[model samples]
Target: MDIISCLPGHVIDRILSYLPIREAVRTSVLSKIWKNKWYTLPNLVFDKHGVSDVASEDSLVDKNKIVKIVDHVLLIHSGPINMFKFTEDDVIGEILVTDMDRWILHLTGRSIKELVLEFLTGEEEEEYYKYKIPWCLFSCQSLHRLTLQWCWLNPPKVFEGFRNLRSLDLNLVTVAQDAFENIVRDTSIVLKNISSRKGN
Candidate 1:
């Protein structure tokens, strides 16, 4: 039996948390005791740097494969998904809207505590389209930390703000002044910290 496999489950999870999700999943092949350990990983991150490790830069931005990877993981994952971070470029942002919407809808049901979605849209001068955040995301009461980049925020009418959100980071996001004020100034929602960059 492998000595490392004898570590406590929480310790093993802590070790896995430091690794890229792909590497974390690969640990399942290490031993019987390690098998299925990755299935319950609370944090899932899919980003350009992570994918670049597996494929060339050209194939790294393959949005279809990115969608499939996210879809397949959420489809089979059995436990709670506490954190989900997906960072991709806006090269194919239009086509990925539906997938992004679906992914958020799926994550909301999992009691996601932290959600980060960054769609890099090249330079400041370029007028790339922004992905509008799904209304379902605002309803995720479990969210403690939320980060979004290069996206539009249009919360629905019935939208009450995230009750449990503690930190919010927005970079190059588009939101109506009133809507933004509603989140920050509203008495119902209390955010301990907020960091926002340029907005349009």
Candidate 2:
């Protein structure tokens, strides 16, 4: 028996699920049966650096290629994803931000259960330019976990109607300490865990 045929479908799926999205998609070439498996893996991860070969901002062609790959993955994933992760290196630059927001909106509309965003921003006047956390996330009825790293939030507010949120992790995120406390207090019924590392 062929090695690919020997493994059960469920077994293969389980193994693919653990890999980063880029690698998982590549497994589709293994066989026709595996072609659509990546779209239904229940987890979506988008990292520009992970899918690109260029190591620096000097190459615009490489950057565009990476963005297109990400767009293709999101466009094909038709299932309700369990988690969505978007991470980019500090050197990737700002041109990709718009595409990132578009992907976040798409995932949030799918009722993603968990969302993790890690991005870098300029240090000078840091408080003035904060990453915008898509509002759709706050309205996601299925969202239970949220993690934001090296991000900034302006006018941070408690998710007024969210009743399913359970865990929140913030690393190097700039938010009013009092506002953060109030948001937790207001969501006390469903908010069980919170870990934060304040930014400068």
Candidate 3:
């Protein structure tokens, strides 16, 4: 008898959730009981750099692979997604932005809590162009922590701040003072830490 298999499905799912997506997915080959177990994970971290071992910074192959893997994983995800972090960009294919919005909108519908959007590509301008967050994020009351780097922040006029957000970290991002003020004034977020930095 397999002792590990005796554990509840939720407990095994929680353990798999902490592993990197690649590792988590690879576990499906272990046995019948392990097949599709990762679909229950609530946390999803899609870091492009970690997705491959390639050392070349300009590898379009890596970028394409990252996009394909992300699309596949999100499509098969069956359980509630509590957190989603996507941090990377470079010569994105024609459908990158549209695909990203589809993924972001999907997570929003799942009541995602912790969201992180970081663009660390060498080009700052392209990063901004690719990281335009979805409109749904502004009204996502389920969000509890948000971290944005090398992206623009344009909270909508009718935006009510993240009601559950406890931490906000923005670095090298563009955010107007008025939009920020609206969130502080209108939203009930008990922010524990709020820090932002600008690029030179």
Candidate 4:
């Protein structure tokens, strides 16, 4: 009579993987078997508000809470993770950056295969916006897919050790065409595809 029992394991896994990490963790209450199943999911997607619901009009979600959730998930996760996606508002403060760096380092150590970092920038002058990609990501050997959105790179960041990389997507990010070209050209790994769209 269990609802989970009626679903195929792969189907259930796919459904659970799409849920935010917190909601996915909560699924453990369904049953003991379900609890273990959540830990085996190969994809990990995190959003700014995933760990905490509290945010002031001018503040971001708590960084400490995010670190705790990431640590807890990595601690219990079984099997190799396939993807890590992070989406955040562009107004990140100084304190949050430090915690975010730690979290990124943790994921890279796990040999993640795909990484998507999306920063949502509100209506603002292009000249006034800037973003720095954490360097730890460039060292991930297992990373095969990378996506960056609404981000800017100063002095530009170069990606290396991604021998398996096949796809790259950059959307609304400000980088010289040459720098962008250098990234794709240097890879020489038959980049499967590259796509970009201008930011409004």
lDDT for position 29 in model 3: 77
Model 3 per-residue lDDT tens digits across residues 56-103: 565566666677888888889998888888877553445566777788
What TM-score goes with each of the models?
A: 0.85, 0.79, 0.81, 0.72
lDDT assessment of candidate 2: 0.68
Q: Number of the top candidate by TM-score?
A: 1
Per-residue alpha-carbon lDDT of candidate 1 for residues 131-194, written as tens digits (9 for 90 to 100): 7888888888888888887777878767767778777777777775457865554454444334
Q: lDDT of each prediction vs. the true structure?
A: 0.76, 0.68, 0.72, 0.67
RMSD of each: 3.0, 3.7, 3.5, 4.6
What number of clashing residue pairs does each candidate have, in the order they appear?
0, 0, 0, 0
Model 4 agreement with the true structure over 8-78: per-residue lDDT tens digits: 88887988977877888888888766777878878887785465453445444454556567778878898
Q: How does residue 118 of candidate 4 score in lDDT?
A: 77
lDDT score of residue 136 within candidate 4:
75
> Whose lDDT is higher: candidate 1's or candidate 2's?
1
Candidate 2, position 111, lDDT:
82
